[model samples]
Target: MTLDERAARRRYATVSALFWLPLGLSIAPLVLLLTERGMAMTAVAGFFAAHSLTTAALELPTGGLSDVIGRRNVLAAAGLLNLAALTLLGLGTTPVLLGLGMALMGAARALSSGPAEAWYVDTVHAHAGPDAELRTGLARGATATDAALAVGTLTGGALPWLIGLAPELGARLGEATSGLVLPLSVPLLLGAAVEIAFVSYALSALPEPPRPPTPLRHVLRDVPATVAGGLRLGGRDALVRRVLVSAGAAGSALATAELLTPGRAADLTGAPESGAVLFAALACAGFACAAVGAHLAPLTARRTGGGERAIAASLTTSAAGLLLLGVTTALPGAFALALAAVGYGLVYLGLGATGPNENDLLHRRVSSTGRATALSVQSLALQLTAALTGLIVTVLPPGPLPWSLAGAALLAGALLWARGGSESRPYAIPDATGGPDATAERRPGHGRPLGGRTGARE
Candidate 1:
């Protein structure tokens, strides 16, 4: 790799880590904090639902805004908003205030979704052309992200426990903040501080190619068209559609695991407190597994012949994991817990492996202009499917049924790539100006095995 390519990879990985770290820090304590702040379980669920709805509503528009305005700008805005949201969540007492904070967090999530990855892809492409070894960098970024999450989860979960050990410190903290800053709120406050750092680093470090000066009116005009074009891309391009469907499948599987795991852990441990600890540990393990899988994604692709087959294989592995979870639901004692843990790890591993390969194919099929929007479309599909799957899981009777449903969805997604053909050309959707949208021009030997490490065995 050239010096520029290496630098770009480093920057991308760093930005990814920074962006996700705060989220990880808050993950373990968020629900507990909300409960401590006097929200009933139903209200907590409602707040989360609001968050999901807000994120889903804004995904396309925020993605289009990034594509139209610029990645760094949108990312900086996201960071700032997240900082505010974290502050509110950490200190706010009332449901209204907390709900607003959750909604803002969802907005931040939507705004931040695609810009970082889009920036990396665009940067590396500029530095080393379209056929540059992207899987390595993408995998590194994913690895860094999950690694940050694992670290944050452990640290976040520990902070409250440590504070609890010193009851005087906890009480003093609560008194100083007028009962707003409890021990449980420390992680979120720390996360808010991280957001400040994230914003500063993003603005200073990541650089983007200059886009043509666009007026407010033009931005207003273009975003919708861009979003519409992005929506249409999936319909016209079979490969893109497969990616979207696969995202949905992955989402369903994730929703199933997340919804069921806590209760299962509680049942196994016979106490909610112990189960919470077990779940936190399992969450950390899952993130670590995901990091490992991401680090090995390039090798997985090489062994599997191409990105398509690798995705298929990875999703199949995840499906198997889900089915294993279902089968083990009836098992007794420590052995069942061990198998369940393995199954959980497998699910994340396959998901982590799937991301780089699927996105490699996606970047190959779309131009830089619509790249962020396309990513947002993929994210939207995932979020919507997860929401729907969550609802279904809620209605289904407890047992293995929910797990089976998720496995079936993922298996169907895996089958989408079971049959393969030569890689397709970038679809020529019309730009806002009514001409064919500019695409990354394909060179001779376009779509070789990822990283050019082997022959075109696909």
Candidate 2:
């Protein structure tokens, strides 16, 4: 059965929207409350720092798990973990419990990140064939995350007032987002419920595609080789490396904002609650801008002839935005916030456009049965980059550090722009021609006789 590209892609998009809505809802208020409850200035640094550590630890292993078991299982497990984390977070307010909660969230995020795209690709590839649509859909799926974030943020912000009005109407569920009794916790519980619902949706709505019954043990053992190969592949393909590196740098810069913004806002606002206002504005603005920017993806791709160069441009623009944001004392902070909001907006769109190209690069090089393994390897790189970005932001001074991160990220973009297609132009897999024996025509996972589907499992 050929994969119906649009149908499967829509499912993947739904997956992103459903999975991320709860994530944003839970995250926004929880971070605010956690800071108020126990995040001393010192502990504040550790929050994003710990995210990096937890992210790195879980990333590759979960990716590998998807290859062996299935992406569906990985996503389901992530949702279940989110539910548990939010539950623990709501029930406990102590430092240790909060740390556990944060760690759980990080792990779930890392696990859910890459495997979903790989699964969607496999499904799409199985049914129809590879083309630009798969790439576009993959990226749009990610951008849809910003939309979900916006909707969830607005909903969370409004939920408390809507619930409190029940007093006049004589209703009972209680105010969820109101500062009255920690509306922060309410979002988490609600978000977890949404994710569980999404899990059920996935189970009932999406049918699993056939896959090789590769032994779990052999797949586990091959993870190291797979990772090494993926990195090497990045090195070998300039465009893929450019896209990955540029995206990573841009990602790091954004993570830096996420790392420092709350603390910065607290200093400026003199009220912890005010930070949530700024945070929501930045998040919602970024989301709105990103959605609009995603529509320009095809244009960016057309200009660059690939996503890597476009991603580079995004990083450079982000650097400029961060630099502008750094001197908020002079710009009066609001303007700086506006820049960052718009900056992140474009950043998400740029990455979204380029995401498919990089993934397609890998899929083109590998056979069908080996796509998951190869994808896991790439996921590891992306996650590790994000982890590093978070860690760097945690350690650096909150004010100018974002500027520095953005600048460094711009350097990555510059390098990619300079490198161009000299290397990438070669081995450039043409878009797959729809035909029988898709496997017969495609490249092997590792380009080794031993890298065949059966050999990979062993």
Candidate 3:
């Protein structure tokens, strides 16, 4: 790689780690925290749905906003929103306040989703050309993200426990904060601090390539068109369509795991506090597994001779993990807990492996102009499906059924790529302007069939 390419990769990885760490810190204890604050399971599910719904509503617009206004600005806005959201989450006692916090978080999630990765791709493409080997760099970034999550989750999980160990400190903190401070709130407050750091780092470190200054009217007009164009890609391009479907399935699978796993931990441990600890350990392990899988993505793609096969294999692995979790839900004692942990880790691993390969394929399909928008479209599918899944799982009896349904969805998604031939082959995508015959200008490797390493089109 060239010096510029290497630098871009490093920056990408660094930004990825920073962006995800705060989220990692809050994931394990969020449900537990909500429950402690008097939310029923259905209420928690509703909050989750609200978050996902908000994200879905904003995904395309923010994606277009980033593409037009620049990634740095959009990312900075996301960090700021997160700071406010986390603060509200840490301090707010009422359901209304909590719901508002969740909404802000959702907006933050939407704004943050595609910009950084888009910036990385655009930077590397500018320096190294269109067909640059994206998987290796993308894998490294994915690994860094999961690594941050692993470390942050373990620390976040343990923070509450450590606080409890110091009763006087805990009491003083509660008293100082007027009874708002608690073990669960500590990680979120820390996450807010991290967001401050994130904003500072982003402003100072993230450089943007110059774009023609867009007028407010132009931005308003162009963003909607860009969003429309992005949505069209799913309908117009065969591979893009399949990728969107796969993203949806993956979302459902993730929703199932996220909704069920913490409760499962609580069941095994028999208390919310103990469950938080167990969930933290499990989340840490899962993130570690995800990191391993991300680091192994390029190797897996190479071994399988193409990205498509690797994606299918990863999806199948994820489905099997869900199946395992479902089947073992009824097991007795320690064995069930152990199996659940393994299953959880496996699902994360599969997702980790799948992400880079899938995005690598996606990156080849669209130009830098529409890259972030395309990614947002993918995220939209994921979040929408996840929101629906969250609602569905809430209504279903808590057992293997929800998990089995998720596994089945994942299995169907796996088959989409596994069927091979027409489905796995990329097709030319229309440009963001919706110009006719745009496909005629398809990049050399853009819509190639995946097969041998020579056709890997890295």
TM-score of each: 0.95, 0.77, 0.89
- lDDT agreement of model 3 with the native: 0.83
TM-score of 2: 0.77
Give the least accurate 10-residue stretch of model 1, judged by summed lDDT.
426-435
Query: Residue by residue across 5-65, what tens digits does model 3's lDDT show?
Result: 6777787888888888988888866877888888899988778777877988899999999
Best by TM-score: 1
List candidate 3 segments past 4 Å from native.
1-3, 31-47, 94-96, 266-276, 397-399, 419-429, 435-437, 440-458
In lDDT terms, which candidate is top? 1
Tens-place lDDT digits, model 2, residues 1-458: 44476777678778888888987776456655676566685674576567667877766566556655667777888888777777766656677777777788778877786666777777766675543234456556766776888788878766654655656432333244233345456677788789788788766655666557777677677655454444455565544565556556656666766666667666556677887687677677766666655545445544665444554554455565566556663444466556555554545444444454455455655544335545555556666666677766677655665556665675666566643443234344311111143234433232111212111110
User: Which runs of model 2 end up more than 4 angstroms from their true locations?
Assistant: 35-51, 93-97, 161-182, 212-232, 235-238, 263-275, 327-329, 333-357, 360-362, 366-383, 386-405, 418-458
User: lDDT values of the candidates?
Assistant: 0.87, 0.60, 0.83
What are the per-model C-alpha RMSD values against the true structure? 2.9, 7.5, 3.5
In order, how many clashes per candidate? Answer: 0, 3, 0
